[model samples]
Target: MAIVLRYVDSLDFVKERFIGIVHVKDTSSLTLRNAINEVLTSNKLSFSQIRGQGYDGASNMRGEFNGLKALILQENDTAFYVHCFAHQLQLVVVAVVKKYDGVSDFFEQISLVVNVVCASCKRKDLLREQARERVQKGLCSGDLETGRGLNQVTTLVRAGETRWGSHFNTLISLMKLFVDVLVVLDFVKEEGGSLANRQQASGILAYFKSYEFVFYLHTMYDILHLTGTLSKQLQRKDLDILEAASMVRGTMEALQSFRNIGFAIILPKICNLQNIGIDLVKQAPQLLEYMAALSPCDSFAQFDKSKLLKLGKLYKYDFDDSDMIDLEGQLGIFYHSCIKDERFTSLKGISDLSRLMVSTGKHRDRKCRKMFSKLKLLKTDLRNKIGDEFLNDALLCNVETEALTKVEDEKVMERFEKMYAQRGQI
Candidate 1:
């Protein structure tokens, strides 16, 4: 178990510290609670000082009853639980992709393609050579642009179950090196040492050449590419929940827009690969619904209470009961009360100042310029009130250091010398 502490320093900058990791026998709530308490005790801290707790959406961690979060809250109710946003986004992608049969099958086939082509070093070398030849041909014909780091030899990347961005990279590599992949598969089908190997290659090659597979491949590439961008943005160390929420809503809106008009946008590219069109009208709605529903829980953050109530009323035609009415009423009351509180109305978390600084630097709006001037004055006042040493310490509080012995330094130098000698030989 890992323990992290977040705090605002004298400079009003948000900082995170890694306390330590605790080894536990099991992941039961009791065990986790005890481990956390032990770490707190050893560090001379108390549970009352904690203001927030974050964890993945696990039953043992975030359950309302008999969970680690619940136990912590029992001790100090102020330590509100914030579920891991990145993990939630990852789960959303995984669930949505697997919920659709066509998209799911596309992923499975891509995985198989990677595994088959990279099973042997001979096949890998052949792929590299073929990719090199294609790049050279394209360069000579002036069909492809050549520059630094452009048109390099391509390799198949295996898709990972946990990392959604890897799927995007795999799809892109496959599309870029489509011909080379087909050539390698064809070679394996004909010259394989065993009948079973040849048959497997033949099956994969046929599937790779299918129109249905090609269509889904391009379609999923477009979809995953968008979500993959969101996943990367959410992983940034400086991002705050508000910015992350805003990004999530923007991505959902983009996806909805794509669902309505993406066929026309993607069809031209698909036709370039194969001069055929498959009817997707009957099959697209379900996939679009699944994709739109991926982050339903986070979608609510996009709207104000009034808009939400209006949306609930507008969608009442689909529901034949009063659940929508009850939901809207409850949401109206909750948000109405929360909006009146000063804490909810004026609270700007850690990322606000940094975001303002960026806006002031990049934008030339009157409000932004005035806000930047006020921010500069505030910084000067704070620096004068709190000495420079305190601000310096706050900046350097998270820096970790280690002492290197003389013998270790010599070992590093010797290793570098050996590497240099080997490089000369090469």
Candidate 2:
């Protein structure tokens, strides 16, 4: 059973607000949907009463074809589904670290040793003692989560919405304690621990020593924050649609800065088990910025979906167009206009199957088949399914001019110039 929390607005209450945790069963099996139907049938709360819905980053809960959000939207167009920002940010960092071989190896090594040390009854005790010693030595004071040092490897990778900067501190602190952990492992080995234990410890130590691990720890912050920005927007309160649209616009603007970094190195490598060049690091930041910016383009759907899929591949998050039940037409218009510019069309091979085949398949001649097959597997379109109204919006575009008489315009311009001159900041 899964519990889904929904924010309900109360029109009759004094405070005009209510939040409820609807206990749902095996959401994967449609238990929650059945339950919701039963409740709505019995109570006065119709589909019209629902204002917002939130779920963890579970595929069954957010998937487009059959997830909880899909089922809800099918019933009521007003029930807006907001992806949990905290979860999105978590997935972002994991995607980036998974790219570099060195970083992946380092984390795998850390998890291997951390699991070994904390798995056994005796070893778990040793970890507690280590925690106590660290506390006594003033390195830490609270009951330390030794299990998470291994178990939360993925969680630690991403930043938080409210506490985005904590990810940086988590990495730094982990590195500082890494040596002390090895010392404890050595103590266990000399005390006649199993040979398997010694092997895991040595392997972990060697992995961390590599340059790749160190580089990953250093660069993780950029990717984590970049993702956190998305999470914050996705989870933003639904106070107004205009505000949400503006936030989406800001996110898109920020992501544009990341487009220069080649997709092959940063996004594709993270999404799949592909080898990436370390030199790609030089351009990843700007490229990541560009990737983030693309999120808000309503006509964004018209752009290459294969590219977006590759970008989203690393994480377990989904942004269903249908979920934007209210903004469908607007989104279509945004994406259609976005791709018409000479700049978007000029970007080379962005839609070329031959180039896509290079990364995922062996035969370039059969690239179209491979590309289509891959697209089908993900249940997505290669090109965004944008409508024609986006083109109409583009054609109808005109700067809305506020007409003023020449004398009025001069007076307004003169006052603006006087203010600007006083500032002397330009």
- The reply for model 1, stretches above 4 Å from the true place, is 267-426
Pick the TM-score winner: 1
User: Residue 358's C-alpha lDDT in candidate 1?
Assistant: 45
Tens digits of per-residue lDDT, candidate 2, 1-426, equal 222234312221112122112445455637777777666666656665665566767788887879888888777665667564445445544655666566566556555655655566776556556655665555344444444353222211222333544555555546545545666666666663678767766766666676556545544544444545555565544322323444545554444443334333344334322323222222222223324434433423335444444334322123244433423344344356536643334332222222322443322222110222332343336435633344222222211121222236567667878775555522
- Candidate 1 lDDT, 138-237, residue by residue in tens: 8899999978989876699888888778989999999988899998899989998789879988988888778778688867787777777877887787
Q: For every model in order, what is the number of clashing pairs? A: 0, 20
Task: Report how far off residue 163 is in candidate 1 (Å).
Answer: 1.1
| Candidate 2 segments whose C-alpha is farther than 4 A from its true place | 1-29, 49-52, 78-80, 96-100, 117-172, 189-192, 221-426
TM-score of each: 0.64, 0.43
Residue 2 of model 1: what lDDT?
51
User: What lDDT would each prediction earn against the true structure?
Assistant: 0.65, 0.47
**In angstroms, how far off is 335's CA in candidate 2?**
27
Candidate 2 matches the true fold with a TM-score of 0.43
